[model samples]
Target: MDQKLTRQAASRVPRPLAQALSVVEEAAQGTKLWCGVTAALACLGGRRGRRAGTAGLAAVAVAQLVSNGMCKPLADRPRPPKGWIPHDEVEDRPDSSSFPSGHTAAAVAFAAAAAPAWPLVGALCAVPAAVVAVERVQSGAHYPSDVAAGAVIGLGAAWFTRRSPRLLRRCTSRPSP
Candidate 1:
């Protein structure tokens, strides 16, 4: 069922849409595009925007580490079959394990983390995040389950980061130093 769905989604992507998604996929390389977006928001949003941008970037970093470093290695799942993708995109496909998509993780993490600080920015960030996730499937780089897992990991990372300050305060409050 997963394979069937992935194939169906990949096949239905039109050339222009695929080209656009390919650009998104490329920008997501190493989460550079998202970092840039977050930085821009920070610059434009004042103090509150800065805070949200910082948190969002932090969450993205954590999600990348958790998804690519830990989860992907552990899962060691293969990417979707090459034949499922269009010829032009074949070379753009990553060679790494694909259980949890690092790109999608970073996207969702940024949006989820940023939304708490600035609802408008957070809401805005969601658009690209959703595109990145769908692009992962549309580009034939990941299965639907891979995108889902990445989203979950991203949300978890954001939640953890949000709670870190409280956790640190509790730990330090009792310290002798």
Candidate 2:
């Protein structure tokens, strides 16, 4: 099954895309940048920024956890054909499912949630997201569709969480003085 899928992807994938994926694989492979960014966002958004400052951190955590734990595990989809090739995966072969790239999900979620206040920082998150998607493809950990789906879910989660406060306020009434 995995081999058949790999052949299908190979037959259709443009050389440019494959090359780009390779580049992403190299650029972000084993980099601890994501961890640092996660920490920074958590600290900055903790109690220093605003009443809703932690939204980014919260969104990221929720997005990644769901993507990694619930969604991926439930999907239980197989990896790409070259999954055992040993060149693509940056970390351990996750026992969990692989429908959505957790790294991509977290990156996009953080970007979307934090963009309101920190445009530059949020924008930077896109780099890692793109890299993770590309790396997933190059490493044979996921198909493009999987990465795309994960990205959509992650981004959607962030957007919803970011606006949740305002939406909740509008729905609820304050006590009359």
Candidate 3:
């Protein structure tokens, strides 16, 4: 099923859209796009924007670490076969495990974390995050399940970022006997 879906996604998307998605994937290779967004928010958005940018960056970091460093090592899943993806993108695919997409994870983490700080900006971030998820499949970098897991991990990272400060405060506030 995963292979069949990957093949379909790779073949069915319109050429123009696929090209654009490929560009987006490239922009996201090292979380470059997210970092730029964070910078834009921090510089132009004033207080709330600064908070949103910081939170988004933090979540993206956590999500990238968990999806790429921890989960990828543990799962050891393989990328979709190049035969399934009828494009030059196959040559550029990562050699790493594909159980979770680091790009998707970071994208979702940034969008989710930022949304609470600034709703409008959050929604805006979500658009590209969704694009990255789709690009992962269409480019044969990940299976649908991998993208789903990445998204879940991203949400978890966002949750951790949001709660950690308070959790730390609570832990410290409890007088060590």
Candidate 4:
């Protein structure tokens, strides 16, 4: 079912839109686009933006570690069948375990983590995040389930990072010695 939906999405998307999405996908490679956005926010967006950017980048890093380092290895899911996509976009597809897309994970993690500190910036980030997720499917690089799992992982990483400081404070403020 996931593969069928992925193939349908890949096949039905118009060529121009697919081309645009391919560009988005390329920009999101290794989370470069998100990192740049985070850096800009930190540099120019003042105190709140800096905090948000830091948290967002940290969440993305955690998401990457979990999605690419752990989940992909454990699930070992294959990329969507290349044969289903009859377009040049297919050539850009990655040769990695596809479950829990690292791009989508980083995208969501960065956006969600930033939202708490800077809602507007987070909202802005969401546009590209959404595009990256859809492009993963439209390019036949990931199944729908893979994207969904990636989103969940990304959100989880953001949530965990948001709470971690309090956890650390509690552990450290124990009236040591």
Best by lDDT: 3
> Which lDDT tens digits does candidate 3 get at residues 1-177?
888888999999999999999898788879899889988988999999999999999999999899988999999998988888898877888899999989999999999999999999999999999999999999889999899999999999999999999999999899777
User: What TM-score would candidate 1 get against the native?
Assistant: 0.93
Tens digit of per-residue lDDT, candidate 2, span 12-37:
55667766765654544333444556
Per-residue alpha-carbon lDDT of model 1 for 84-121, expressed as tens digits?
A: 77555655777889889998999999999988888898
Task: Give lDDT per model, in order.
Answer: 0.88, 0.64, 0.92, 0.90
lDDT (Cα, tens digit) per residue for candidate 4, span 1-177: 996898899889898888898788788897788878878987899899789999999999999999999999899888877788877777876688999899999999999999999999889989989999999998888999999999999999999999999999999999968
Work out the TM-score per prediction.
0.93, 0.66, 0.97, 0.94
Q: Which candidate leads in TM-score? A: 3
Model 3: lDDT to the true structure = 0.92
Candidate 2 colliding pairs:
72-97, 88-139
lDDT of 2 at 116: 72
Tell me model 2's lDDT, rounded to 2 decimals: 0.64
| Steric collisions counted per model | 0, 2, 0, 0
Q: Report the Cα lDDT for residue 124, model 4.
A: 90
TM-score computed on alpha carbons, candidate 4? 0.94
